[model samples]
Target: MTLAHFLHGLRCASCGTLNALWLDLIRALVECHQCGQTALTLTDTDEGRSL
Candidate 1:
């Protein structure tokens, strides 16, 4: 999936560390790279606003 956005300063729920996350717009998911946490799952409406 192509990355649509890069979200910075996101706190990971699993690791409790602030990290920059890659937003996969096609999948509507935002995941933490540091701890492999699925930080957010966005809906269609939310996806549009994110960009």
Candidate 2:
């Protein structure tokens, strides 16, 4: 089977740490390098809004 993936962005809910995200493994939990916190939430803020 063929696989597809997309890369987005991720932010820490507590410290506001932003990073790249891959849609292929989004279901898998990721951790933040700065605050040592796991990825709890993801949002699209390119349109000018607070996530």
Candidate 3:
């Protein structure tokens, strides 16, 4: 999967730490690298993430 967009220096909602957004497969997700927590998950495809 390739990154469609990235929010550099963004804050995580779950961990309250700086994070980056990346595209995994068809899903756009944000994880706190410091805390290893998934802060958010969004559908990157027209029908959402799929196998």
Candidate 4:
């Protein structure tokens, strides 16, 4: 299983629509793009601010 993060949220930069994808792997994350939506690209942060 993949590591789960609370930061599991995708914000459509185009239409500003927030969608949950982590919980749903069957659906394409960019499907909303056809309707003028952008997928929120996630950037993981260090567990303790790695130096």
Q: Name the candidate that leads on lDDT.
A: 1
Winning candidate number (TM-score):
1
Between candidates 1 and 2, name the one with more favorable TM-score.
1
The C-alpha stretches of model 1 lying farther than 4 A from their native spots are 44-51
Model 4: per-residue Cα lDDT over 1-51, one tens digit each: 444332236664555556633322333234343244424444367655867
- What would the per-residue lDDT of candidate 3 be over residues 1-51, giving only the tens digit for each residue? 355555586776666665444334445455456666654465466676567
Tens-digit lDDT string for candidate 2 (1-51): 323243347665667767633233445445556676655435555866666
Better of 2 and 4 by TM-score: 2
lDDT of 2 at 32: 57
**TM-score (all chains, Cα) for each model:** 0.59, 0.37, 0.40, 0.28
Could you give me the TM-score of model 2 versus the true structure?
0.37
**Model 2 clash number:** 0
| Candidates 1 and 2 compared by lDDT, better number | 1
- What digit string (tens of lDDT, one per residue) describes model 1 on residues 1-51? 476677776676677777646688877788777777774574585756753
